[model samples]
Target: MAHLELTGLCKAYGAICIADRMSLSVPEAQVLGIIGPNGAGKSSLFNMISGDVQPDAGTISISGRDTTGLPSRRLAKLGVGRTYQIPRPFGGMTVFENLLVAARFAGGLGASDARKKCGEVLEATELSHLTDETAGGLRLLDRKRLELSRALVTDPELLLLDEIAGGLTDAECISLVAFIGELNKAGITILWIEHVLHALIEVAHRVIAVNAGQILADGSAEDVMASKDVREIYLGSAEALA
Candidate 1:
């Protein structure tokens, strides 16, 4: 069975439908990248899959278990980890402390185990040197790394990333892409919703475009980007995405 599956998922707010019978299946450890125009419902889709929003219909399953409508906290405990577009670290906490909390709560580890896991995550994210720094003091790139570290501390089977590379320098973006590639190689199933097209192309094995609450295209990264319809829909924003 696929590690993560969404079958005929639908979500509507009154007359406005945000997800229209969306369906997808991701094999274990696959890197799935989602791209589209501004109102593509990409973030909404992440929210639904991460259990932050309840779908009006259809099913979300992880490892053959129905997960639709489950709360976010429950999803976290079920081995689903996620990062937002805007990083939200605990402002007063130190870098290691932030991940330690996630390890203990989300992964159900005891204090010592949580600390060990936290150390591992900090190393993986290249934040070990800043373990004592306050989270609020991090720059944009480091903050993004912290977001990723927080998710990693959960030892998640599935990782949902929503525009984690939205604002970064070209060098920083490249580094982030390389790190994510390494993570995927280490067996983490990832679904990344990103406007950063170049970064996605570097990491994702498959690319999909979502528009107006539905998937518009799905295929190899090159093929999806070359599709005429995708081009027409996102003509002006190509540079930003790239």
Candidate 2:
């Protein structure tokens, strides 16, 4: 059975239909990428899955257990960890402290366990050198790394990443892509929403494209990019932006 399933997912706010009965399934430990133009309900989809927003209609299941409409805290405890498009580290805290807090609050880890987990996550994310740096002092790339570290501290089975590579340079993006690929190879299911087409193509086995609240294409990276609807909606126009 698929590890995560979104069946007939729909959401609306007043007259705006943000997700129109979108459905998809992701098997265990696979990497799925989401691509679309701006305002394509990409972030909204993450919000729904992470339980920040409840759908008007649909069923969300993780490991075959229904999680639709569950609170974000509940979902996190269920091993669904997510990162936002914009990194939101605690400015007053040290890098290590920020991850320690995430581990304690989101993963419900004990003091010693949280500290050890935070250390591991920082090392994995290559932030060990900046452990004592103030979160407010981090540059863009380090901030992004910190975001991923925070998510990883929870030891999630499923990771949801939103634009983690958006502001990175080519070299940094390649490094981040390699890091994510390594994570996937280690058996973590990943659902990534990114505007960086090349990066997605590098890491995702399958790509899903959403437009105006509906899925327009889904298949292998090459196949989805080659789809008529995807080309017409965003792929063809994306070169200038990419």
Candidate 3:
């Protein structure tokens, strides 16, 4: 059975359709990469899957059990952890505190386990030294790190990352991508929407290109990037990919 599956998903706002009978599936422990244009509905799709948004019509199944329209908190219990394109850590809480909250509530861990998890997460995200600093005081990259940390502390079996590599330096991107590879290797299923194709390609086992909420292409990274439809969606940037 697919680890995550969406069938006949339909969503729209006024005349704008973000999902048009879209269907997709991700196998266990596989990394799936998604690429699309600015308004191609990539983030919206993420929202729907992560329960930030609900589809007007569809079925979302995890491990063969229907889970459509479940709230983000509920999804969290089902082993789904998601990061937003924009980080939204609790501004008043310290970096470590924020993670502890996620570990306790979202991860459903006991106090001792939550503390240990948050400590490991802080170190993993390179925020160990800033554990006591309020989240709002951090720089953009640190906020991004915290965003990812919040998700990781949940110990999700399926991880959804949205533009997590967008603002990082080249070196930082490499490190983050390598870390993601480690997560997948550790048996986490990953669905990542990335504008940074180079970084995504490093870890994604399969690639899908979305255009106007439709799957424009689905195949190996090289094949998907070479798809005529995908190339047109990317426009002149195809030359840059050469």
Candidate 4:
């Protein structure tokens, strides 16, 4: 069964449609990348899958079970996890504390288990040295890592990543790509929305291009990026197709 599936999803606010009968299915353990222009409803799609936004129409299924309209907290317990484009850690809390909260709440771990999960997540994200540091004090790279850690602490079956590589240096992006690759290797099914084409290309097994609330292309990463429609809508110029 597909790890995640969306059928005929439709959403709109006023006259602006964010998702127009969109549908997709992602097989287990696959890394799928989504790309589009600004205001293309990429994040809106993620919101719906993560249960932050209810679709006006359609069904969402995880592991072949209906999960439409479920709340974010409920979705988390069902093994759905996500990271925002902008990292939203508790600024006043220590790194370990923030991870512990996700482990306990989202992961539904008991106190002792939550502590063990936090330690594992911290080590996995290479944030062990900063475990006692305030989340607000970390630099951009560390904050991004924390965002990933928080999502991973939930031990999700399907992970949604929204532009987690947006503001990193090339070296940092490479590091993150490596980490993400490792996560996928560990059997986490990932659906990533990223404007960093190279990073997405490195990790995603397949790619889909969305625009104006509909999918324009879906195929292998190279094929989708090379598609004329994707180039025109997302890259904005034929020069990128060259």
Candidate 5:
């Protein structure tokens, strides 16, 4: 059975539709990449799956159990974890404190267990050096790492990442790509929505392109980028095709 599945998902705001009858599935340990233009419903799709917003119509299942419209906290317990396009770490809290909250609330761990998990996550995300730093004072890269660390504290089976590589320098993006590759190797299933095509292509086993709330292409990363429709959509942005 698929690790994560979305069937006939539909959402709209007034007359503007987002996620119009969309369906997708990701197998266990597989990395699926999602790409689209701005406002093409990429983030909205993540929102629905993570239960930040309810779809008007759809069935979402994780590990074959139906989980449509479940609240975020409940979904977190069910092994769903995600990072937003914009990192939202608690400003005044220390990095360790921020991760501890996720472990306690999202992972439902006891104090000791939460501390253990937070430490492990910090090590995994390479943020141990910043443990005592205030989250709000972190640099962009550290903040992004904290976002990833927080989600991982939940020990999710299905991890959703939204543009985790955005705004990084090329070298930093390369480092992040390697880090994400390591995460996938560690057995976390990933569903990534990113405009950084090269980074996504490097880590994803397959890729899908969304346009106007619908899938325009789905296949191997190379093939999807080479698709006539995808090329047309990214016409002038040659980097997206590269």
Candidate 6:
């Protein structure tokens, strides 16, 4: 069965339809990459699936169960985890504390289980040495890592990452890409919306481009980016892909 599936999904803001009878299915452990220009409704589509936005029509299913309109927290308990385009860690809390909260509330773990989960996550994310540091004090990379680490606390089967590599240095983006690949190798199904083309192409098994709330192209990363329609959607197409 598909890990996540959307059938005839529809959403809109007044006359601007964001999803027009869209149907897609994501199989387990597949790293699907989404590429599109800003305002192409990529994030909106994610919001609807993650339950931050309700669709005007259609069904969303996870593991063969109808989950349309389920709230974000409820989805969290069902093994759906996502990270925002921006890191929103609790500034005053320590790294461990932030993760502990996610493990307890998001993962629904007991006290001991929560602590253990936090410890394991911190180490896995390579933030163990900074476990006691205040989140606000972290530099950009560590803060981003914390955001990713918190999402993992829920032990997500389907992970939604929205521009997780945005605003990072080239070297940092490379590192993050490798880490994401490792997560996928360990069995997490990833649906990533990313603008960082080079980094995305390195790891995604398949890529699709969305334009005006519809799929413009779908194929291997290079093939999709090479499509004439996709190029036209991106300003200075060749440069955009580069």
lDDT order of candidates, top first: 4, 2, 3, 5, 1, 6
Minimum summed lDDT over a 10-residue window in model 2 is located at 233-242
**What are the lDDT scores of the predictions, listed in order?**
0.91, 0.92, 0.92, 0.93, 0.91, 0.89
Model 5, 1-242: lDDT tens digits are 99988999999999999889999988999999999888989999999989999999989999999999799889999989999888898999999999999999989999999999999889878899999999999988788899999999998888999998989899989888998888889899999999888889988999999988999999999999888888878664557656
lDDT by residue (1-242, candidate 4, tens digit) is: 99999999999999999999999999999999999998999999999999999999999999999999999999999999898887898999999998999999989899999999899989878899999999999998788889889999999989999998998899988988998898899999999999999999998999999999999999999999888998888766788656
Error of 6 at 222 (Å): 1.8
Misplaced by over 4 Å in model 4 are: 237-242
Q: Please list all clashing residue pairs in model 6, or write none if there are none.
A: none
Q: What is the TM-score of each candidate against the true structure?
A: 0.93, 0.94, 0.96, 0.95, 0.94, 0.92
User: Model 2 misses residue 41 by how many Å?
Assistant: 0.5
Candidate with better TM-score, 1 vs 4: 4
lDDT for predicted candidate 5 compared with the true structure: 0.91
**In model 5, how large is the Cα lDDT of residue 4?**
88
Candidate 3, which segments miss by more than 4 Å at Cα?
236-242
Worst 10 residues of 1 by lDDT: 233-242
Give one digit per residue, the lDDT tens place, for model 2 in 83-168: 98888889899999999988998889999999999998888889999999999999988998898999999888999999999888
Please tell me which model should have the higher TM-score, number 3 or number 5.
Answer: 3
Model 5, which residues run further than 4 Å from truth? 236-242
Q: Report residue 140 deviation for candidate 5 (angstroms).
A: 2.2
Q: Pick the candidate with the highest lDDT.
A: 4
Model 2: lDDT of residue 225: 87
**Least well predicted 10-residue stretch by lDDT in candidate 4:** 233-242
**Best TM-score goes to which candidate?**
3
* Per-residue lDDT of model 1, residues 1-242, tens digit only: 99999999998888878899999999999999999987788889989999989999999999999999899999999999999887889989999999989998999999999999999889878899999999999998898889999999999989999888888789979888988898888899999988889899999999999888888889999999898778868775456556
> C-alpha displacement of 61 in model 6, angstroms?
0.5
